[model samples]
Target: MHIQMNDIYKAFGANQVLTGVHFDLKEGEVHALMGENGAGKSTMMNILTGLHKRDSGKIVIDGEERYFDNPKEAEKHGIAFIHQELNVWPDMTVLDNLFIGKELRSPFGLLKTKEMKALAKKQFDKLAVTIPLEKEAGLCSVGEQQMIEIAKALMTNAKVIIMDEPTAALTEREIEKLFNVINALRKEGVSIVYISHRMEEIFAICDRITVMRDGKTVDTQMVSETSFDEVVRKMVGRELTDRYPERNPNIGDTILEVKNATRQGVFEDVNFSVKSGEIVGVAGLMGAGRTEIMRALFGLDQLDSGEILINGQKASIKNPFEAVKRGIGFITEDRKNEGLVLDFSIRENMALPNLTSFSKNGFIAYKTETDFVDMLIKRLRIKTESGETSAKNLSGGNQQKVVIAKWVGIGPRVLILDEPTRGVDVGAKREIYQLMNELTDRGVAIIMVSSELPEVLGMSDRILVVHEGKISGELLKNEATQEKIMTYATGGQ
Candidate 1:
């Protein structure tokens, strides 16, 4: 299943995202497409999977030139893509999800329910995935959801499979399982195109690597023959020294303190304190109550019992308004759900948290709002046409910037970021990391909840691991590692 994209050219209005990008994927091999965020990686994937039409290109699959009108056409030609966002329906069971569009039928055209369940089970068993077949897709962990997406791809009997940032939310152990599954697929002669920002995973799983920068193909090399630094330099087009900046040892008074926080079954006994000018990372496995704890702190969830102290004063935060007034900001994990209003313009979204500042005597001030939004867009390097552009129209990385811009617009002393870079690409991820350092430099107390071990280790001044609704352990930056974090996360004493 060799895939060849010859001289691909694509553009959005005056913006040319992919300029003569060319690459080849060999049969039974894992090929990685590495690039900075907004470097045409997603655009290339969309072109290959038929989500977007290329302006000009030659797509040869198994030596046959074909044009795909849509994703179904690509699927019919043995091509499947598992996007970074899970496409499974939340209300559908695993059995129903897997067989939704292509259900087996009897002679009378009646749906074959038992056959679908058996087939879904067989698919999971074949991959050694242990998720319950009858459970709703939304109830599973992020890693489990990813595995189900993989299983869905396998069910298509695809000869060529494209995985976009598949391990972004997976744990170390879960990542290993995915690697095994990929290897099995390779043994069965399926070619895989893997897109990822993690250099370690790319080197571990990919056989060949193609680097893209500024919408152009920079170089292609065998994974064994290239170094991580060289690959990163190529992707970023510059030397990125010190991925994590050193913290200024200027610890001030505790800005926020939570004592014996409990929210019934969601989380309990979550005790933590974040000081000014420090970054505290909450590290844990998926569904380990990390997000729930943050939600309680942000006054988004009802707490059964707890005490919240802001600036050494006990404060009761009934909702986001009160929380914001107390100098607290929460950037939710689900950006689409809680962070940004997609239909609103960038100016409207950015000015949402600062309506009071942009209002004068009960009247909205559009000029002030637009001025602040423009400043934020420029400061964050958010690539949008204007502040008037709709939030939904921006790319994934740009949309994340919009969310951050909204929070920064209001001037928060205490910031809470949940999975800040969950599915962001390489370039945007670096920008976000640098932004975090800038925030801490300004004496802002930052609390981050992340499932990625590397991010926890790289960015945090301190790490707290949670297990089954309890704070299991805390470690200084010097003591935090993948092994140490996993030990505490799995209930080790």
Candidate 2:
């Protein structure tokens, strides 16, 4: 399939999303769409896939102008979108999810279970996915769920696949497998619209790149012909200084410590400590109990047998409220569901944790709340029309900033950040790193659980590697390398 989108324009009320955006995808090629959050990359793709209607544009597919009425109609014509958030029905079996809404049926109106399973197995085999078809989709790991979505698209015989941030939650090994499948799909004449914030992955896989900024096309170049610096400049409309901000340590005494923290089946013997004005990074593969340990610390999950010490004194954290009251703030990995209320306005979401501070005599102070939200918005450079705007309307990077801002509002002594910059762009990532430096400078201890090796090495003062629910090894910032981290993460000394 060959597609050309010319002069695309879209607007929601007073907010203009896309204007004169041009994008094209050639058959059998991996095309990258690079941009900062709210630069209209996703919006343009949504228009292409018929999820959003374009006000004025020409969509030329195979030399003919075409506009799909809906996503299903677009999929019927061989276009499939695998969103960043995988859409897997938790209670349903994997087979059911794959054949959802398009199940095969016999002449007597009975379901064709055998035929569906056979077809699903064939697609899974092609993608090298080993997930059992009988297992519940919700039980699958993020990587497995991603593969299921890919196999589901392939099962539709989709010649054009749009993958949005496909590897955000995947481990290194899982990412390699996904790359292999993408290569195979390209060879099979499947065109891909690969949208991601990871520059390394973009250069590694994409054949051609299109840069967008402020809802307009900036430039399009072959990946081999363009440089990373050049693409970033095009995307952000300026030269970004560093991928990570500098960290000058003023290490203090331990602020929080977990001694033999055991969650039984989830994690075991997770011993670590973070000092005031220090950033301790937890490195491990996905499902290596990295997130589980953080959850236990934040009181989201109970630690079966362990000790949590705050400031050299035992602290009991039975729930999120208690965690917050003890000055321990948590920014969960899954921001959409856990961190923020999507339907609420930015002011409301930011006030959820700090309402006590903004309240007086059992009455809320609206002025104080708005003032605080406005300050954080400006401090974090969150791009939004106003604090009254819904959280769901902002881009991924902005949403992440909102999450961070919400945590910062409580004035925490110790902050736990899980995958802080998972799907954020390069510019916003640097900003977040700068924010971390500022927090540490203000005597805030931080425990960052991350899967990205460079991020771990760059921002952490100390790195702790997790393997099979245990702390495998610890490395100082000066000694930590990607190879050493991987070794420890994979159960090496």
Task: Mark the 10 consecutive residues where model 2 has the least summed lDDT.
Answer: 121-130
Q: Which is the leading candidate under TM-score?
A: 2
User: What C-alpha lDDT, on a 0 to 100 scale, does residue 247 get in candidate 1?
Assistant: 58
TM-score, one value per model: 0.95, 0.97
Residue-level lDDT tens digits of model 2 in 38-117: 89988888898899999998999999999998999999999999987668998999999999999999999999999999
Q: Report how far residue 410 has shifted in candidate 2, in Å.
A: 0.9
TM-score of 1: 0.95
In candidate 1, what are the lDDT values of residues 227-282, reduced to their tens digit? Answer: 98899889878887766655564678889999999999888888999998899999
Residue pairs with clashing backbones, model 1: 37-427
Quote the lDDT for 196 in model 2. Answer: 95
